[model samples]
Target: MKVVIYRVGQNQYATPVESIQSIERMLPIRPVPGAAAHVLGVANLRGSVIAVSDLRKVLNVEEQAFTPESRLLISNGNGYVVDEALDIADCADDAWEHVGEQKVWQRGDQLIVWEDLQA
Candidate 1:
């Protein structure tokens, strides 16, 4: 299956590229009070307010300063976040075999968290 690979913490994870809406750079985020620490804040994405989450913080990884490579990967019905959006790659279903036994999280029975890219 084709997937959009990305980096988070110290590992790589794959999400089907078809679900991605867009990849954007860091924009001004309005801090939300009384929200989860992982919630970076919200930003206006082309007139639509989007919630931005810190992948590192969310995964309990060490915090790192945002660099030019840092990006927001909006997916899963336009409501998702990833660390650095890596290039899209085509991988066969067999290729995913290596991902076995990793922490996988299901999203609506459609997507699964392959692995922590930071690892």
Candidate 2:
């Protein structure tokens, strides 16, 4: 399957390209009261209001300040903030190794966490 590989802190992750609508630059987000802790809030992108979530918090990683490399992976009308958009590659299904609950892929020294954005 083809996947969009992204970074969160020093770790890398992958989500299927088919599940992503677009990869966009970080947009201005308005915080919503009483929202989930992992949710950054909503952003207005091209006249569409979409809720943004912190992939760092979702992955239980340390949150870092948004940098120029920060990107939003838009999926199902929602956005997930990631450290950077690294690459898009075709990965064989047999390449994935299940570690407990996570599906991980090894690329030399780097390990990419495979995720289903639709989940």
Candidate 3:
């Protein structure tokens, strides 16, 4: 299966390309009052407002620096934070393992974890 690999903190993850609505650059987030700590804020995608969140907290990874590689993975009208949008990967079917609500696979030297947006 073809997947889009990305980083959230120091770890790399992958999700089926078809699963996401779009991949966009880091967007300006407006703080939301009384929101969760992991809730970065909301962003205006074109004209629609979408909630943005940090995946690092959910994955329990230490926060990392953001660079030009940083991007937002849009799904279900939400924009998820990613340290970097790596590349497209072609992984074997047997290489994937269903873990919780996510799918994990090996990509070269590291493991690429897939986060389920619907969960």
The parts of candidate 2 lying over 4 Å away from their true place are none
The best-first sequence of candidates by TM-score reads 2, 3, 1
Model 3 gets an lDDT of 0.84
Candidate 3 residue spans exceeding 4 A from truth: 98-103
- Clashing pairs counted in every model: 8, 0, 0
Per-residue lDDT of candidate 2, residues 3-110 (tens digit): 999999888999999999999999999999999999999999999999999999988999789999999999999999999999999999999999999999998788
Model 1 accuracy (lDDT, Cα): 0.67
Cα error of candidate 1 at position 113, Å: 7.1
lDDT of 1 at 103: 41
Greater-lDDT candidate between 1 and 2: 2
TM-score of each model, paired residue for residue: 0.76, 0.97, 0.87
TM-score attained by model 1? 0.76
Full-model lDDT for every candidate: 0.67, 0.94, 0.84
Candidate order (lDDT)? 2, 3, 1
Per residue, candidate 3 scores C-alpha lDDT tens digits across 36-71 of: 988889999999999999888768888776678889
Worst 10 residues of 3 by lDDT: 110-119
